[model samples]
Target: MESSSPPADTNRASTAEGLRFAFGTLTVLPVRVARWDRAAARTGMVCAPLVGLVVGLVAAAVGAVLLWCGASPLLAAVAAVAVPAVLTRGLHLDGLADVADGLGSGRPAEEALRVMKQSDIGPFGVITLVFTLLGQVAAVAALYGQGWAWGAVGAVASAVVARGALTLASREGVPAARPEGLGAAVAETVPFGAALGVAGCCVAVPAAGSAAVAGSAGQVVGAAAGAVLGLCAAEVLLRRCVRRFGGVTGDVFGAVAEVAACGTLVVLAVL
Candidate 1:
C-alpha cells in the first residue's frame, strides 16, 4: 500500500481560520484593557463590572453552600481562595510572586523582567506569596465566622476594581514593556470610563448592602474607605512601575490586581 500523503496548505489555512474564529471567545482581553476606540472602549467599560459580578456570584454561591454543609469558616475561606485560583489558573498569584521578586532584587528593570521570566521563585517572592495567602485566608475566615456577607462582596468587588486600576494605568501613557502581549493590548483599549464604572459598581453596591447590615452610616463610610485604599494602592504601584520599567507589563498589571484585591480585603476586614 502506498504511504498516506500529508494534508495540503488548504488544510493548514482551514485550521488557522478555525483558531481565529475561536479567539474571540477564548480571550479575557476585554476585562483588562478597554478598547482604544471610543465606542469599543465604552462598551468594554460598561461590561467591566460584569467580571466582578461573576466573581461575586461565584464566591457567594460557594460560601452559601459551604455554610449550609456545616463546614467551618476556615474551610469556607479556603474555598473562596480556591475559586479565583481555579478560575484564573493562578495567574494573579504567579504575577504577585514575580513582581515581588523583581521589586526586591534591586536590579535594573530589564534585569527584573528577565528574572521574573525565569521559572524559579526567589526568597522575596516566596515570602510575599506565603504572607499574602495567609492574610487572605485569615481575613476570609474571620469575616465569614462573623456572619458578614461583606467578605464575599469584597472578593467580587476586588476583581472589578483591580481591573479598573489596570485600565486606568494603561491610559496614563504607560508603554507596554514588551512589543506585543496582553499589556499592550490593554494599553490600546482601556479607557477612563470603564475604570470609573468598575469603581462605582464595586464600591456602591457593597456600600448600600453594608449600610443595611449595619443599620448606620458606618457601612458606607467603611466601603468608601476600602475603595480609596484600594485605589491609592493601585496608583502607587502604577507610578512605581512606570518609573522603574518605563511602562507597564502584563506581570505588573497582575501585580496591581493582586495588590488591589488584598488591599480591599484588608480594608473591609479592618472596618
Candidate 2:
C-alpha cells in the first residue's frame, strides 16, 4: 500500500510555505518587500505588536542575564540592544535611512519616496543614521548607569510600546504612495487588539514590579509617562506622514519605531 504521508518534496514545500506565511504575517519583513496581500498585510500589522513583545522579552531576558552575570550596566544595555538588532537584521535601521534620505532631499513627496525606494544612501541618510544610533547608545548607557534594572525595563518597554505606536499609526493613516504595498495592506488589515496588547505588555512590566524595591512609585510613574509620550509622538508623526506622503510607508513606520523608542527612554530618564 502507498504511504499515506506526504512525499518528502511535498512536506518540504509545505514547511516552506508555512514559514513564509508566518514571516509575512508576524513582522515588518513583508512591509519591506511588499509581499503581503490585503488580508495578509492586515494580519501582519496586528501581529507586529506581538512580535515586539517577544522581542522585548528577549531583550529584557538578555539584559537581566548579563546583569546577573556581573556585567557592567553599560554592557548589559548594549547586549539588550544587540538582541533585537540582530533578530531584525537591522531592517528598521534601513527604513530609518530611507526616511532620512527622502526627508533631507527637499524634493516633493513623490520624488522623495522614489528616492527612498532605491538602494542608495545619501548624506542625510548617513548623518541621520549616525545621530540616531548614537542617541540610543548614550541614552541606554546613561539609564543603565543610574539603574540597570530600570534601564532594562525601559529598553524592553520601549521596544514593545514602539510597536504599539506603529500599529496605531497604520490603522489611522492613509494608503501607500503607490497602488499597493505593505502600507496599504497594513492600513486595511491591522487589528486594533494588536496595538492594545503591545501597550498592555509595556504597562504590565512596571505594574508587575510594583512589589519589588526597584518598583517604586517613581518607577511606575516613569514607565507610564514614557509610554504616554511615546504614543503621542507616534500619533503626531503618523498624522504628518498621512498628510505629506498621502499615507504611511515602511520607512515612516521605521521612523515611528525609532522616535517612539527614543521618546519613551527620555521620559523614563526624566521621571
Task: Write candidate 2's Cα lDDT for 148-214 as tens digits.
Answer: 6666667777787777776676563245655555454456344456556656665565445432536
Each model's total of backbone clashes:
4, 1
Cα error of candidate 2 at position 165, Å: 1.6
TM-score of 1: 0.80
Off by over 4 Å in 1: 1-46, 212-215
Q: Which structure among the candidates has the greatest TM-score? A: 1
* TM-score for each model: 0.80, 0.78
lDDT of 1 by residue, 15-114 (tens): 2232222122113323332123333332343444455456656866797689779998888887886676666667778877888898888988788778
Score candidate 2 by lDDT: 0.65
**Model 2: lowest-lDDT 10 consecutive positions:** 1-10
lDDT scores of the candidates, listed in order: 0.63, 0.65
